[model samples]
Target: MKKNFILLFLSASIIFFGCREKIVTVEAEKNTNKGGLLFKIDKVNAPKNVVMVEAILSRTDFDTVKASLNLVTETSADLALNNIPIGAWQLNVNAYDSLQAIVYAGETVVNVQDGIITQVNLTLIPTSSGLGSIYIYVNWGKIPTTAWNDFELNPILPSPISSTPPLRCNQPKVLYDDGKFKMWFATFKYGFAPNTGYAESYDGFAWNVVKENLFDLQKNDSSSYSRWDANCVIPGAVIKENGIYKMYYVGFINSSGEWHIGLAESKDGISWERYPEPVLKANSTEYQISAGDIIKINGVYFLYYSFRYNTISTMPVQFTGGISLATSTDGKTWKRSETNPILTKSQGWEVSRIYYPSVIVENDRYDMMYMDGSGTGFGMASSKDGYTWTKTTTRPIFTLADTKGAKAYEVVYPFCRKINNKYFLYYSSASNSDMLTITIRVAVK
Candidate 1:
């Protein structure tokens, strides 16, 4: 009886050990299936006093946490966190000063796939109020650092393989939505025969030209006012209304020598059809419409454009006009504001001409970045109502000092877009080396 009892105990022990080994193997396999994250963080204005970093990761639902990491750092750090579960996660990173207070903070959402390492790049801005809203009148927040690249994209359709005069590209309209970053710009060779073109990118930095001349010059007719846009078509502001893309552009016949605003619609962001007549024309022969910015608020379209009373042969094109405002209910018929020119020449930097108004309405205020006719640089203004604008300062908000002249001849045509909670100001300029060739550049805040 004692021998049988010992044998039974040994058999039970062997089966239990076998089961334990199988469980260990399965657990190891599960660990190997996990994914990781490698984050490359760029500190926009990291203080010299920053001494450490605190990085935290949580599930997208905020119900569970993956990791809480702390590290000693200098001005900036490249952080790595591994073994994150395969799913969506939010990363909140903070840069701390010597006092252990958060000097800068940034957060971004990332997707981790099984057995894959996801790479993320982020620009961290300071949490201190010093980094955000500093203004006596118009609050522009902070000045941005410029991102200059040598990449160039030529006109897609009207570009001749070999032409007497080279083609030029300008006026970029950037949009990030539906999982893609898209741009629509104008390109023309010689003469004012401009057309709208398309380019796209997975990331905003590198661009791929998709289609050139998506919308070409409209058909010309006999009537002078009706034929105003026959020669060249340059798109100003593009927005989606009722599931369709609408573009407001300045159309002009170089021969007629006057410009007016026209409207076009597209089912897709690409391919467009123009309305038969100009939506907003120069009712007052005193001023002719030029390129402007448009935004929709409460189903009303606000159009802000520059205008010139008469063309001067010796005057530079950029300095011809000031900024004006008009409103449209259907984006077809429009009413010029009672106070027509909302913003005009107010300071020496403006050179008695202010145009290229880029307006962003935020927090019950209208924030505008505009270029003066001198092409010296841009200025900032704010308004409660779109009509009564208050210039932030007499100084130019963006300009190139004497030493920076080698970088760009002049900066004009400001456009602002916000991505990942960061503000990017896009504009066209000519480098001193290639003053005639216009190129696009960006400044990030």
Candidate 2:
């Protein structure tokens, strides 16, 4: 009886210790897999008497929540939530009044990497009518009354060093950073393939061209898969993030003759090394990808690009084109919006084509300047969210006639810049007499 009692006590202690060890191990694993969020809320078109805002982090399916927090305030406030399970989450926010009635609500998707504090921002949209209508304070102030100077910087940057006659200078993507002006432009010689070159300016007008190309075609046959961009590379958008200058461009495959969105990075805004393959491609066989503009918002990279059907039809003639959006966390991997083709051909002036998007977010609103491929003009549009757009009542903000007697018949590839409270629109203008020849021009407000 005594031996049996001692054995039973030993067995009970072993089981208890084993279970305790398992509990501690599971707790440590849970802590290791945790991440955090720093959230900022902006209330636009919100009702008065909003007393509290609650943020909930839920799974992708909206089936379960991982964590949540609340802030009581009448205005925008920043809050931090810690120790959420490291994974993908959708942030849902609800603005409540003193009566506990829901006033405004919104949700945005985000990815939480291990041991990282991902920043998120939510723009609240009201669930019901309110006192003040939601208005985006773009504050772009009066449109420029001043006529664009054709001579200010026509043919802004010269042709390539190896001069081929009838030089082509088009698709200007300029960056004003660190008190200096830099540009990545597409330069095409008469018979040679098109490539991207660099230029710099200290005063934003007088430019000194970099002698070499920033991006070029691969040195292989176009038919080879290795030569994805063996024919042409054109600059799309230029942005500086975390001290690194990144360029999103369009690369054409000679064999397929289809364009794809490509990426390249530089430290000095010149001398870029491109990735081996295109980062974004067409999911459908009937469309080809084109130039894209990228902007970072709430720790997510939003890329808006143009797509036209594979029919090779002409605008105002036969075919159609539209604008789409894709989001990325690291700016490499991308997920296309399910509701794509956000902006499509609609109005008479557009003529069935809308491509070459130059987009920026100002005052919690998205502003885009784009070209209608069939027309000789470009228009302006704005959005509260990046997905849906509304064209400005005064369409074709700038047109070929706006340049007056510049022989600029067609205007394409618009890039917008705002500095010192002034707005500047940079675009490529085609010669009215010679359609093949192109020049760069700028209009300032």
Candidate 3:
């Protein structure tokens, strides 16, 4: 049976309301023409005694509207307005107390698409916050508003190494340490990640690419006949673990062209050594997989990897992409989390195919920057425990149009690093949409 649950949260206030059957529909994932919405209000912002809450979902023509049951939730629950028709929507949410008094109310925009799971976290602005009539603090799956100043600069540095026709630089990992900025990128032909390059700068802006390939696949054990990543090798999340630098990379097989996660190690970010075997490999259900980001929490390593499910037709869109998690006590031996796919595509520019997640830890939250694989755009998300992420906005914070004067074809592979309290995003442009031919650029905020 189709069902929807409603939840209300606020600080020092509690409200409970109900939804009309004609106004909402809870759906199953079997529907291709519809999408899912995960609607939630921050409990800390909710009052102490909300007995009821009302959730209203209104949509446009393209997003189909059908009727479903609305169940009143008694406590904290996983919020969902599932199988919603894909289109722009308006969600009006309100909270009520035991006396049925409306203490907090707010409205926000929601966009839905089949396969894309949109998350909207609401914070209630009470009357005490000055001339406010209860506004919803919702980022709607985009970057935080306080993020960048829309500052972008082109031609920051050269490709990891020089490349010839049909081969271009792709996938970058940047780091800031000891008052210097260092970068590692890959050089690959179409559909193959074969080599890595290095660059450095005293300042995060100007960079000089050393004319060297950090590691050649032909020289590493990856070149072995039985190695899964013999065909491709892309640089991924690099982090310092136990005073030793670890690199998690994407590797592809020459025969099946399948994707796998590989490992490398370095004392410094420069010279590196590789693990003889793939650390993570795709199962029968995954079409392709690549590393997104990695962070350690309480001695456990959290590895975020982007993947596409085997069923393309069942997706909201053909290229629907999601990010999942795997944990390892020893970065080499790993196990997939039961919660796999901790993140999925959100609506707007990220409705399908979001990949290459770059993340950094700030305070207690994990901040993320991912590429919109369906289009040339980049967006942000955050997580508390490195599993469930909150997409900051509904739209991409920046896109191909944001990179001025590049006049490039497809600008992608967004790698962000925080230096001096500012985020520096480094990305490249592909002459062809398939990540061939490269021009690296940067945006600071």
Candidate 4:
């Protein structure tokens, strides 16, 4: 009986040990099925001064897991997943708020192995916002910067001309004509002297003052008896027709201190003849209309200007100004396309005033340059169609840099011209005392 019991116990022990071995093999296979997952935040190409990286993970089993990871000194975030279960996982990463929300979220997926690290790399995008008020971009490819000839200490125009007192030259209108470049500019000079002037350039470097004090700011002998643009002609000239140079000049009278626009025409690029009647008149009881630059695209002429004080009696007030558009077929009679300002100062340096629009058609796109006091520099806006404009990234195309104790004030009227596959920007610069001095600079593509 004892011998029989011993043999039975041995057989039972063998069966139990064999079953345990099978269970161990199954667990080993399960462990091999999944590998380690590894991930990292790529910050090599990121902008400077980044703080933390915000990460989000999504999967079939989980909704979304979000976390803000601190960045190392290398501006990168390293993450490791050791012995992760075999499955698909998605990751999204963005920059932290302390970094000015500069980096955009990146997404990716990976499959993990038990002991293997599945490396996945991510790239972050830079943050961008709409342009504030003015937009200026240099097309250096077409117009090389090296092509711009340096100006003498006191250069003179190719043609003999005289220099007048520095006027408050603001809005600039430019066009190529008769193998020469011409600019019509406006200033804040009150009285009998013309507020708008004309300047000509052969190679867009040295300017020759063509017409100085060209417009008669005296009161017109009419029933209106309104002196056009008495206080100033902010933005001076617009090309109404191909050969006809029409200028929408601002006029203010001492009687009411109200501002209006006067229209004038020029053919030879110097002498201008003003229309006996004011092309656009301001409402005495309501807001006044101040005209800006006028541009023609595909035979459609658009007048972009501003309006202010459309309400009851108030002090000579400049309301939140905006850019408005007017359409004209014959370039004579114009009707307001929309009774609203197409573009206005919503934010940035131009938040206070967004006036003096200078537009140029490049690569079938309209690039408008204007000024903003908020930052005291120039900004840019783009428009596919002349009417609808999208404020682009407001980067100061030009700024007042102090040079030898003299500080530049503002960059007004940026005119772009291409020469020998290079682009040149002829702009007017002034000091804080409102001295009008034109500066010619070039940018290469």
Report the Cα RMSD per candidate: 18.9, 23.9, 19.8, 25.3
How good is model 2 by TM-score? 0.63
C-alpha lDDT of candidate 2 relative to the true structure: 0.62
Q: What is the C-alpha lDDT of each candidate?
A: 0.59, 0.62, 0.63, 0.50
Model 2 bad stretches (over 4 Å): 1-155, 159-162, 218-225, 312-318
The better-scoring model by TM-score among 2 and 4 is 2
| TM-scores of the candidates in the order shown | 0.62, 0.63, 0.61, 0.55
Quality of model 4 by C-alpha lDDT: 0.50
CA lDDT for candidate 1: 0.59
Clashes of each: 1, 0, 31, 29
In the range 1-445, model 3's lDDT, one tens digit per residue, is: 0011111111322122222223346553444586655434434324465555566776543344322221235354334454566667777766666776766566667666545445443434333332212333232333444544422224544532345553356577887765556777776555434777777654455455763467655644533746666666677887875667788888876534467889999987778888888899887655678887788889999888888755546645354567788999999999998877777776667755777788888789888888886556888899887878889878887776676534567657888877654567888786445544576677765
lDDT tens per residue, model 1, 65-132: 43222334333234444445566666565656678776555555656667443544332322224321
lDDT of 2 by residue, 389-439 (tens): 888745687777777334576788888877545566778877657577776
How well does candidate 2 score on lDDT at residue 246? 83
